[model samples]
Target: MTQQKVALVTGGNRGIGKEIVKKLIEKDNAVIFTYRSNAKEAEDLIAEFESTGIRIKALKLDVSKIEEFESFSESINLILNEWQVTGIDSLVNNAGIGFFVPFEEATAAQFDEMLNVHFKGPFFLTQKLLSSINDNASIVNISSTATRVALPGFSVYAAMKSAMETISLYQSKELGARKIRSNSILPGPVATDFSGGAVRDIEDINSRIAQQHALGRVGLPKDIASAVAFLCSEDSAWIDGQAIEVSGGYM
Candidate 1:
């Protein structure tokens, strides 16, 4: 029998991260997911999949907390030992925060938060986990459509995501010697609990965002999750160093 592919996903307890975990698991992959603070939700997610006969593990991780990555790497090593696997086959950098503040009002604190979580977090986490990832493994960085188009108040958030996109390119180039593939996925307005759930719960915000997409609707978590799954799988073997916009043709 073919061995199950294992993936490490950050912020997997909720939002897009949660859905990505679900999608990967449904595709018969073993996943080690991370949750920052909501231990209850993480526990609930593990319990929710208990009947499936697969052991799903959730680790506590704050992506912005670079200091914890060393110990976190040790924890991952323990899991790898338990699984009897050499290393993880995929790593998804999906944890993030968002705010729609204009450039003039964007605080240094907010920019630092964005930089830490969206760029520095993923950059160093991937570096620390490099040995834990098997050759030919996949790295999927979650980016934003704001980097593609100018939004009213997404200057700082988009800039960080754009930086992440640049990091993805460099990762792919540098890791190519190991046959590892790195790519970014830019998702348009998804109706998730992100940014105070304005896109999900507020009628006007949701409608306006949906109207901008060629598909006439905002994205769902599953829509982006499916793309992520594809990228993680061997099906996308030839796709590398690319930023795929999974925005339903958002203009």
Candidate 2:
């Protein structure tokens, strides 16, 4: 019997994270996902996937808090044991909060917040979880198109994602010894409840974003989720240290 894959997804209760969890489950991966504080939404996600015969575990995690990652690592180990897996086969660093402050107007605290969540958090969390991540496992960092295109309010946010992109290259180079692969997915504007859901709820902003896509439509959670599924599968095994932009051909 082929061993089933296990994935650890951060911020898996809503938006792109939720869709990633759903798709991974459908792909037969047992998922141990994280949500910051939404116990109700987390519960709903687990309930939604019940009876799939794929185990689902949700833990409260604030990716900004690097102090808790050691304990988080312990929790992951216990969950992996419960799932009868020695280590997770994939790690999707998908937890994030949006910051819309412009560079000159942004406060030091705001910049720090972006760093803690978007860059520092994932860096340290993965370091702590390295021992529990199996050899040949894939690491998917959720980046943004902001890294490529300059948007007015996303200076600090995009800078942090650029930092993550640099880290992905190093992760691929160093972890290659263990056959582990690291990559980043840069998605263009997507309609989700992130950043107050302007792209999802406000028609003006939604249409504006949709028009930017070469496909003539804004992205949905499932769109990015599908890319993640591909990256986590054997089809992407030969692909590593790459930043794949899944933006519906947005320019």
Q: Score candidate 2 by lDDT.
A: 0.93
RMSD of each: 0.8, 0.8
Report lDDT (CA) for all predictions.
Answer: 0.94, 0.93
Candidate 1 residue pairs that clash: none
Q: In candidate 2, what are the lDDT values of residues 1-251, reduced to their tens digit?
A: 67789999999999999999999998989899999999999999898867766699999999999888988888998988787777999999999999578778999899999999999999999998999999999999999999999999999999999999999999999999999999999999999988999999999999988888899999999999999989998889999999999999887
Total backbone collisions for each predicted model: 0, 0
Question: Which candidate should be chosen as best, given lDDT against the real structure?
Answer: 1
Q: Where does model 2 exceed 4 Å of error? A: none
TM-score of each: 0.98, 0.98
Indicate the worst ten consecutive residues by lDDT in candidate 1: 47-56
